[model samples]
Target: MSVLNGISVSVGPVLFKAACPDCRSRFELAAGALRLAIGGSRRTTFYSFTCPECGSAVRKPAGERIVELLTGGGVRTLRLHSTV
Candidate 1:
């Protein structure tokens, strides 16, 4: 079990509903299948998932709300630092 935002969630193999825009195929994916990145700029911050049906990579913008949900859902997240 895991606690997210103070809410207890079952930590076992949980499936999340995902859709492939390219092939229009809908499927379920585990938390490990998704990746989230928090970047310094809006354009750099996004979430990624692979489409099992078409093998296409999908990336979507991760706004504040999306970030919260993704993190709470146990998706592995990475912090991006700008080296300048």
Candidate 2:
């Protein structure tokens, strides 16, 4: 792992490795690559990402521990407000 001209090359476990389900391309992404949304309901709390290789939108449910790790790791986050 090396940083070339400010670009990181997976120096450590700090960066997450994701696999695109559509294209099957594996790549390393920083916490910035993920987005977390916390909502009024437990079912609404989750994380989202776009697969760089296939351009497919991917969303996964985030549990309590996941939310903690993601937030601690610097992942961008949004809070959802219910109109009802």
Candidate 3:
């Protein structure tokens, strides 16, 4: 395992396996790339992404899918879809 910057490397067959924090359901993900959607009335920031497997309603109202990316000096995360 290679370490990029201070965070672990995220490449090759990246698998994001986690239980839905809301539903407590296990999820296995295999996405080609991380997705992001910018939104907000006053402040702009990184929001949650979406789930390809489960429908939009599963994580709606706000973002759901977020992936960890390693950069030159640090790590940046991008959301796949936003519920809101």
Clashes of each: 0, 0, 11
Which regions in candidate 3 have their CA more than 4 angstroms from the true location?
A: 1-12, 37-43, 47-54, 57-84
Q: In angstroms, how far off is 52's CA in candidate 3?
A: 6.0
Q: How high is the lDDT of residue 11 in model 3?
A: 62
The per-prediction CA RMSD against the true structure, in angstroms, equals 3.9, 6.6, 8.1
Q: What digit string (tens of lDDT, one per residue) describes model 2 on residues 1-84?
A: 788999987655567667777888989878988999998778999988899888999888889988898898889899999887
Query: Where is the poorest 10-residue window by lDDT in model 1?
Result: 11-20
Q: Indicate whether candidate 2 or candidate 3 has the larger lDDT.
A: 2
Q: What TM-score would each prediction reach against the true structure?
A: 0.78, 0.73, 0.31
Better of 1 and 3 by TM-score: 1
**Residue-level error in angstroms, candidate 1, position 79:** 0.6
Candidate 1, residues 1-84, lDDT tens digits: the string is 879999998857757787888999999998899999999988999999999989999988889998888888899999999898
C-alpha lDDT of residue 1 in model 1? 82
The order of the candidates by TM-score, greatest first, is: 1, 2, 3
Clashing pairs in 1: none
